[model samples]
Target: MPWAVLRLHRAALAVWGAFLLATIGMLVWEAGINADSVRDRIAACGHDPGLCRIRAVVDYGGTIGWASTLVYYSFFAVAAFAGGALIGRELENGTAQLAWTQSVSPTRWLAATLAVPAVLLVAGGTVFVFVFRWAWAANRDLMGDDWTFNDVFAARGPALVAYGLCALGVGALAGVVLRRSLPALGVACGVMYLINHNLEKSREDLWPTVASGGSGGQFHPESHYWPMHLVETGIVLGVAVVATGAAFWVLRRRTG
Candidate 1:
């Protein structure tokens, strides 16, 4: 069953591999070559104290920021693939029915369909998150990012993996409910987008804001960001579990 699943999704696996390689390559370049260049510019500016060479650093930061943005938003692609390729296409073309008749239980088929992609998503997302974290922290002077930034928040920790898992769950639910490729793809993407958007907006509320001075002064300590991120990760993971359970339940009802 695993081999058959692998064979069926070889194209997606290849694409995922290529994306992972490209992201890692970009991070390596940013952390190595671009970081060196930024450091050199900083040193040169310090020595001269006249020519401001900080624009170069900012430009490089912008480039790295764009690359990281793509990685941060990769869950959308995962959701699309899960809906359009993984389950929807199979059900639409009667392939899932064929598999079911070949001594494969509906539950097992659904499990394989979700499990294989979930593993790959976690592996790929974790690698990108760690690499991007290193690259992002390598030269803080070159970056204008903060913990509150959307892409930074999503790309820096286990939240990235959580988002991928949640997307997969939402996609599975959409595919099972719609049982069509295009509609499932569209609905899944939309649902994931909403989930992400809402979460990003309410992320700060996950943890209470620290009031430093008087009633007029309220600021979030940097130390609180990690805890907030963990809380958000838990929320996303909870969503994933619910969606997955709902998908399985729906599949069982439909098949039985």
Candidate 2:
């Protein structure tokens, strides 16, 4: 079943591989090469404030920001794929029903449908998190971003993986509930956006923020990164578990 799933979704797997490679390559270039060059140029100024040529910093920061943004929003694509192709299309075309009528049970089919992509998502997401964290941390002076930035915060930690898994579950639920491709796609993406947006807004509330004296607003210190990330991850995974359970329950009711 896993092999069948792999062969069926080989195109998506290829696309994911290409995207992962390209993004990681871009981060490597920016962090290892472009950042170093920018530092060298700035250091060459050597106490001459007017001679400092750091124009490259803007370009470097922008590239990194773009990468972070891509990683941050990647869950939408996962949701869309899960809804429009992985589960919805099969249901819409009667392929899933046909499989269930054969030796494969509905529950097992659904498990195979989710397990393969979930594994790939975890593996790819982990690599992306590590590489993005490295790129973001390298030469912090060249970056205009901080730990508090939305894209940076998620892309640098386990939240990215959690988001992807949540999207997968949400999309699967949407597909099973809707039993159609287009509507499921729209609903899955919309639902994920709502959840992500609300979470992003309320993220600071997840952990106790430290107050800066002298009229500065309360803020999270560097130490808050893990606590906040874990909290959000827990929430997202909770959602995933609920959605997955609902999907299985719905399938059982429909199949029975």
Candidate 3:
């Protein structure tokens, strides 16, 4: 059993989890204490009688929620570092072939290794989502004319998980094909970052929609369906799965 994967995943969560919690706690606390200022700001922005209201408005509620989501995304970086090191380091030390020589087949090895970090990712996501829902519920109506917690939490949350999975897949693929861990780590990290760049570019910039007919009118950014974000996220997860399968097939064939 490649215990390295489990260790890597735990380390990623232990280290990154603390950071994520700290950031969220502070923001939530800030929001709670500063509710008055936040409310005033929201009222000010909402009362504006302007032409073509803006979408990217940040209110206290949005601020609290945004802070949580931003910290949640920091998981991607943690996953890249830990996931890359998982197989990449083994391949670097030239000990990865040792797996093939052992009774454990390549497929089993992949499953065991991948499971470790996958659990960590899920745990982290679960915590984030729970906290996000709470924060959103608390601040929902007070969220402001142009800000939204849904935008901050839902869309970006899944994307972060997909990114982590892709990073691990990158490491595995590199190990199987190149048999060198450091190079694999570098390549995987770089490629995932590049993909993330594109994901960001294509990411829909959504905000609350303006409430119509009212004298002052409610305003929000052009909101999007949260489920639609699954499309790109699924695409990323698909690439990671394909790459992983190919790596396993190639490695097993080589071993046999």
Overall local distance difference test of candidate 3: 0.60
Put down candidate 1 lDDT per residue, 1-256, tens digits, no spaces.
7778899999888888898889789888987787887777677776664446657666777777777788778889888988888989999999999999999998999999888888888888888888888888887877885678788777888998999899899999999999999999999999999999999888878998878876777778888878999999999999999999999999999999
Q: CA lDDT of each candidate?
A: 0.86, 0.90, 0.60
The best-first sequence of candidates by lDDT reads: 2, 1, 3
> TM-scores for all candidates?
0.93, 0.94, 0.68
TM-score of the candidate numbered 2?
Answer: 0.94
How well does candidate 2 score on lDDT at residue 237? 97
lDDT of 3 by residue, 1-256 (tens): 6466556456655776787677657656754666666555545655572421222234454566566556545534643563356665665665556875877666787778777766776666666656655665575555553322334634344755665667667667776676665566667667776766676565543234455675766643435445445666687799889877877788778768
Question: Which portions of model 1 show Cα errors greater than 4 Å?
Answer: 42-52
- lDDT score, candidate 1, position 34: 71
Clashes of 1: 0
- What is the per-residue lDDT of model 2 for residues 24-102, given as tens digits with 9 covering 90 to 100? 9999999998887787777776776353554667678889988888877989999999988999999999998898888
Model 2: lDDT to the true structure: 0.90
